[model samples]
Target: MDLFDCQIIPVPLTAERQSHISFWPNWLPRERADALLERSIAEIPWRKDSIRIVGKTIPIPRLQQWFGDPKTSYTYSNIRLQAVTFPEWMDTLRESVERETEERFNRALVNYYRDGSDSVDWHADDEPELGFEPLIASLSLGAERVFQLRHNLTKQRLAISLPHGSLLLMGAGIQGHWQHRVAKSKAVHSARVNFTFRYMNGR
Candidate 1:
């Protein structure tokens, strides 16, 4: 797809302390988005992983698949993930994002939320391996969901409705200051797929 042919604009957010979040409600065409969602569900080797929280082992809410360049393994919440080869479709999409955002990414973490029961807790992408500042490009498909961000110190909050085919960019310093999550909602019964691309600093 030609970058010039696509008109993806960012959705503005209310003024919040040290927060950088923007969204393109329709980064991909509806047909393309649906196709990608179906292919992702069929091709990716998704699996459940658990994390230790407060001395208890609990399964992570959603299924995940981590794939990227060599040595792009990542760890967080005491869970380690090794990098696996990515599919051509994902690689092409990553290039498109880089061209539009003027940024580069070497790793991708995909999350699959099955129905309303699956969700992620509030947390920042501030792992040591991500460096002091991190830029995350998150693309959503299949279903719409609400993504919330809260300030680390000010207690201010912002919420955005992320629809299918949308792209959300979390800019530098955003992760250092703001925490975000996808809350579970009984109203949503369809599945959703989120692809978050990042520049991993790993061995």
Candidate 2:
């Protein structure tokens, strides 16, 4: 598949100016996407993610792994994630995303939601290390899920069904205006993997 040859459609999820997001429902071919999903499940070292709340440690609903330059470290939800070298396949994928988006992304945060119960809460990617007006590229694989976005002030919400092999690009000013999350559902029995690429301040 040609990484740059995608049918990207603009999504008007928010009315705020300069807050843009685009979605490509079929960014990748089905066979290749399936193969990548299987390979990721087998080769990627996924770890159970946890968060610290009120001095108590609790496991998050999903598994995650960080890959990038060794010096690329991130802090979120009071947890620090040290970056590890990306595998050969991931490096190639990251390069494709960079070429397609024309954005320099230094790190990829891979999240695996095992079954329907695993999910992420509503939050913005406005970490101090991400710098001002960060651009994020999110790729979804495996099972489909509901991705929700909500305006911070208006409380307006938008729910999107994210399918396998889909790509969503969240542009500048989005984190400042909206919060997003992958809502959980009891009906989904399979797993879903998401790769979110971001540019950091120092690495």
Candidate 3:
């Protein structure tokens, strides 16, 4: 996709605060995206991590892996993910994302949604380890999904249909004031893989 083919979406954080999201509907060609999706499903060492809730342990709906400096670890919802060294292919993809977005990313959290039943609940990437006002660049491959966001105070909501090969950048401060999620839908039967690239200090 052309670098100019980006959509900037304004998100209201508060009466006096605002942020934006940058999205590219066709960040990668269909054929390339297809190949990447297949390869990722086959090659990545996916983990079925579970979380404890209400004194019971339940597996997350999707599989995931964390990639970055092995010295650093990320924890959220009581699940601690130790960083795995980035493989060559993922590093190359990260470089490409940085080039397109003009943002530095040293870590990535990859999620694999097997089908319609796999979903993520609303949450903010506001972990203290991520620092304040973290920026996230999320790339989607394979099936399309609806990415929804909701304001913290006003409860206002917005949804975007993310197509295969699309890239969406959650700008600074958005995570601080809004929460987002990929909800389940029976209409989506195919698989999808999302790569959310982020930067960590001291990495």
Taken over the whole model, the C-alpha lDDT of each candidate is: 0.83, 0.85, 0.93
Give the alpha carbon lDDT tens digit for every residue of 1-203 in model 3.
56539999998887887789999999998898998899999998999999999999999999999999999899999999999999998899999999999999999999999998999999999998788899999999988999999998889999999999999999989998999999999999999999999998986
Best by TM-score: 3
**Per-prediction TM-score to the true structure, in the order listed:** 0.88, 0.91, 0.97
Task: Single out the weakest 10-residue window by summed lDDT for candidate 1.
Answer: 4-13
Q: Which stretches of candidate 2 lie over 4 Å from their true place?
A: 1-16
Model 3 C-alpha lDDT versus the unseen true structure: 0.93
Query: What's the ranking of the predictions by TM-score, best on top?
Result: 3, 2, 1
Model 2, CA-based lDDT: 0.85
Alpha-carbon runs more than 4 Å astray in model 3: 1-4
The TM-score of predicted model 2 comes to 0.91
lDDT of 2 by residue, 1-203 (tens): 45444444443435645456777788888998999899999999887767888888899999999888887677788678888898989999899888877889889889999989999999998887788978899999999999998888788777878899988889788887889999889999999999999998665
1 versus 2: better TM-score goes to: 2
